[model samples]
Target chain A: MQLDSILFYLFAVQILFSALMTITRRNVVYSAVWLISTLVGVAGIYLLQGAEFLAGVQIILYIGGITVLFLFVIMLVPVSEESKQRRFSSQLWIVLIVAVLLTGELGYFLWQGADSFQMGEPTPPAEIGTVTTNSEQIGQVLFSEYLLPFELASILLLVAMIGAVVMAKARPGAE
Target chain B: MEEILDNPYLQPIIATLLIVAVFPLVAGYMVLAERKVLADLQVRLGPMRVGPYGFLQPLADAFKLMLKEDIIPAASDKWIFWGAPVLSTFTALTAFAVIPFSDKFYVADVNIGILFILAMSSLGILGLILGGWSSNSKYSLLGALRSAAQMVSYEVPLGFTTVTALMVAETLSMQGIVQSQLDKGVWIAFSNYGLMLVPAVVFIIAAVAETNRAPFDLPEAESEIVAGFHTEYSGFRWALFFLAEYASIFVICGIAVTVFFGGWLRPFANVGFLETPLNVAFPILLFVVIGAGCALGAVRVTLAYEKAIMGVLALAMFLVAGLFAIPMINELIIGFFWFLFKVLIFIYVFIWVRGTFPRFRYDQLMQVGWKYLIPISMGGLIVNGIVLLFTS
Candidate 1:
């Protein structure tokens, strides 16, 4: 196989394996570590697809920020007590049924091939003589075409931040 | 054979190997330099026994560390404890892949170079956090939490200051930033009608905090926490953490140099008249002066071995200075010399700060990051953006 395809398969296998480990691990911290591995594998796939900007964001936001927070929380909690409890609940049959149905649905979609999705051909990345880089293109499109949605998202985040602060703050009347 | 050598893939592999092999030695010497600087600042003679002027102190320290017994606490999480330092070292070294060392000597000039570095350094926090948590000690846990919190908090200002530079450069590539500076005839730190200096100052402060250096080094404050996160770690594992620390220091300082100060540009780079003098003659003159100092020391010292070692060092320095006089070799190495000169200045300043300042209280560190730095960096970005908009 070509090195590109080999790399893709490697990342694919790693993502799947780590995702499984993430969900299956008894220790929450171990699970978080596995989740980081899974996220990094996804980033590798993004890099393989030439989406360098997206890959960087994936690693930074997910592995760096979110996973570190998850680790922090994991360290804080009574993890030994939690780990002593059962890994699964009495609702296993229902979960198994849902899992099987989801797998079947995903398999069916994969078997149907690309024509069923009805997506257009994607534009190739810029070359030497082309206008700017992929990052620049992303920036331009984000600002110009998706300006409203971008601004709205920023406002939404700001609202969330305020809500979090207020929720965490002590009541004025109560010490 | 020619085709094999010409392969595009081979260069990066060679560069990677070269960095992996050379960086440890560089980091070791950086430690020696730091100790010597610290000693000088404190008015004490440092490490005179290992080699003349303690030149071989890093090598001796490395040997001693390697020979020491490895210890893993009985209560510690064995796997994580074993892996944490390795993880830290790996991430720090990997960040070097995107760092533009000079005009020609870089591993990979990725499009997202700065972000790649930021991501790698962020990942390095996990090493500290995991090492601390795995140690299963209160001091370790506290240190890790402080480090994680400090790094995360400072990263906001660091990011903002970087964004300000990126706005001026309009590129994320390390090499591209240097090229932008060259093209504009000004470093980003001095650009934007001098508004860029605000972010530059903030960046320096934030970078210092980000790397957990003194004055912001609440994470590993020896007085309170007993070496903090690596308290339980011993011998080579501890050395790995030290390696990661110094390597990250180099990487962070490198980013500042690349983004703010012109990466490999000589002083007065744009001035035509000063080019030959600053670019060529200055390094030679500087090294010759250093070699002369070494020779004088060698003559003054009474011990035979110390005199011999000093003489050898002086000879080596003179040889290096002589090499710079050759046109071909000078052309090849001048960029690297300028780049390393700036980085050494940065490293010296880091050690100087460590020597001069007392450790910050945890609350003060947090206040500086969140309250002072964050606002200043944001305002600097806005001001620079406005300046760029009107001036351009």
Candidate 2:
């Protein structure tokens, strides 16, 4: 096999294995660590796709920022007692139903193949050539075409942040 | 053989191997340099007994650490404790892949070079947090929390300052930033009517904090929590953490040198008359003076073995100076020397500040990072952006 396919299989296997580990682990911290590996595996996939910028953002924001926050919260809570408790929740039937539905949906898509999705064949990695322009092209598209949606997403984040601060703040003279 | 050598993948692989082989030794010597500088600042001799002028001290220290017993706390999380230092060291070394050491030497010149470095550094904090948590000690947990908070807070200003410089340089590529500086006939620090200096200064301050160095080293403050996160660590594991810390310090300072001071570019690069003297003659003269000093020390020392060691060092320096005189080799190494020279100055400044400044109280550290440095960096970025918008 070509190197590209070999790498694809490797990253796919890593993502699947790590995702499985993330859900199965009893310890929350261990789960978070596995989740980080899963995110990193996704990032590796992005890198193979020649989406360098997305891969970097995936690492920085998800693995670095968000997962650290998750770990911080996890560390503060007493987890020794929590881990010894039962694994499965009362909503097992609901979860299994959803899982089966999702699997069926994925299987259907696989059976239908590329034509049914109405998407074109992907641009080959060779055609993409130098990776430097990948980010520039992303910037051009983000700013020129998707500018409004992009700004709206940022504004939404800002509002959420302000709301969180307001909620977190001690009420006036509550002390 | 030619086909294998010509493989694009093989080049980066070789570069990665070279860095892995070389940087641990470099980090070792940086520790010696720090101790020597700190001693000089305090008016004392440091590590004189190791070899001649303590030149082999790092090697001796490395050997001692390696031979010491490796301990794992019985109550601790064994897996994480085992993995944490390795994780820390791995990320630090991986970040080096993007660092443009010289024009010819780098693992990969990926487009998102600066971003990749920043991301790696962010991931590096995980190693600290994990190490602290897994140690199962209050001091380790507290130290880890403080380190996490400090790095997270300071990263804001660091990111802003880098954004400001990236604006001026107009690219995120490490090599591209240097080329931009060359094209503009000025370093990024001096660009935009000196407005960029604010961010450069803030970048250095935030970097010192990010690397958990002195003044801002509240996380590892010996007096406070007894060595912080790695308090329970001993022997080679502790040494690994130490290596990672210095490697990250080098990486951060390297970014500062590349973005602000002009990586791999000689000072007065645009000035034609100064080029020959500064680039060629200056290094040769400096080496000659060092070689002469070593020779004098060799003669003055009473011990025969010490004198012989000093003579060997002197000969090495003289050989380097002689090599610099050759045109082809000069062309190859001049950029490397200047880059290293600037980085060494940066490292010295880090040590100097460590000696000069007192440790900030935890609250004071947080306040300085959030209230002072962040605003300054943001203002610098916005102001520089506007100026660039108008001018260009």
Name the candidate that leads on lDDT: 2
What candidate 2 gets wrong by more than 4 Å, as runs, is: A87-94, A118-121, A126-131
Q: Write the per-residue lDDT of candidate 2 for residues B1-392, one digit (tens) a residue.
A: 99997777786788899999999999999999999999999999988888788888999999999999999999999999999999999999999998988988778887899999999998899999999999999899889988988998999999999999998987888889999999999999999999999999999999999999999998899898998999999999999999999999999999999999999999978999997898879999989999999999999877899999999989999999998999899999998899999999999999999999999999999999999999999999899999999999
How does model 2 fare in lDDT? 0.92
In model 1, the Cα lDDT at residue B333 comes to 89
Model 2 TM-score? Answer: 0.97
- Per-prediction TM-score, please? 0.96, 0.97
lDDT of 2 by residue, A147-173 (tens): 999999999999999999999999999
DockQ of candidate 1 (2 decimals): 0.45
How do the residues B1-392 of candidate 1 rate in per-residue lDDT, one tens digit apiece?
A: 99998776676788899999999999999999888889899998988778777888999999999999999999888988999999999999999998887887888887789999999999999999999999999999989989989988999999999999999999988899999999999999998888899999999999999999999989899999998999999999999999999999999999989999999988778889997898778989999999999999899888899899899889999999999999899988888998999988998888999999999998899899999999999999888888899989
